[model samples]
Target: MNNNSNLSSNNNKILNTIDTVMGVKEEKEINQQQEYPPLNGQKLLIYVMGTLAQIGFMTLTLWLINLGFKQLLEYNLDVRINTIIVSLFWIFFTIRSRLFSPLDNTRSRRQYDQVIRPKWAPPAFVFPIVWISIGVLRVVSSYLVWQELNQNFLALPLIIFTIHLALGDTWNTIFTVEGRYGLAVPVVIIGPLLSSFVLAYVYGQILPLAGWLIFPSCIWLMVASVLVINIWQLNQKD
Candidate 1:
């Protein structure tokens, strides 16, 4: 009877050991699955689609601008109406392109105003200057196309300029629209750095005059980025 009881006790202990080992293996597998989930093809497809959409949209904008200039040269539009149309068109286009959050929505963010704004934030006058500089650059680009001057070589700087604009506007949307100021701070810096580098490229390989014209805008962007950093710091509680 004693020997039989001893054998049963040993069998029970062995079963317990087997159960514990299986439980640990199952837990490890669960953790592995959590750490490394399956990569869905849908994400890749969405990324590709988004990139293609942005590229198509920007190219269309360039085409429309060129068309508008052609019409202007032909005196097809009344002077006052043309000015109004161009202003409204650009305003709507920039809004639709998500350059900024809705004015009302951005204004609703009381936290942005709770702290004193940086003194160096671009003043009202600076905006017109920046816009004028951008317009000059666009005109220069159009002139280059009209003159049939090394467009193939100039293409890189133009592409870079487009990218810089997109990134800067996207950063604005992220900060003002999404209220992701922390993430936007880095983006603000990055956008200007990209613009500066592209300006250097334009100076070296493209039109030196065009490069000089855009340099002030680059400085403005850097100043804007610094202001953004200050804003982020002030609103950290959010």
Candidate 2:
């Protein structure tokens, strides 16, 4: 009887061990499934639409604020204080508008890689650095323009600058977010590239130093325009 009981106990232990191992395996699979849920076509469509909606709202709000700034400048505010306030607004707007896109994700990066780039295209890493520098130049140059105007935000140069900012954001949406490379070509030309040149000319008229500061961005945008045109031609189907 003692031998039989000892054998039964060993069998039960083996069964329990197998059950535990199977449970752990099942749990791991469940966790993995939860972590990376399947992204179906409908889900992807919803995500894109949602992102577009958010961007649209943001652009509208920014425009309203731009108009509001025009009214605010009409007040008898101190010049230095107004300059600081206006600079802060532009800085916040620039950073937020640029960084609010969904292109930072792995999927977007993959999509960018899948596109056929020009032989002279700069590396993907160069874009952020270039854009950030350009953004800083924009804010500084605008500040200088405002100061040169004697705190006149209603001037033509500042108006052009505001339009330029809007166009830049719009081009980003069309090119990167919407994946409309063909449509993006014209948008890039008439939008940011044209605006850059206009801004350079206007800024130069207002303040020579401001114009020079923004001129490099114009050249950069010119190169970018050519790059986008090539990209559209190469990836016509995409």
Among these predictions, the greatest lDDT belongs to 2
lDDT of 1 by residue, 140-204 (tens): 54344323443232244544555555565555445544556676677677664566657555653
Model 1 misplacement above 4 A:
1-52, 60-115, 120-154
* Residue pairs in candidate 2 whose N, alpha carbon or C atoms collide under 3 angstroms: none
Per-residue accuracy of model 2 over 160-224 as CA lDDT, tens digit each:
77567656766665566456677678878987899899899999998999999999899999999
Error of 2 at 233 (Å): 1.8
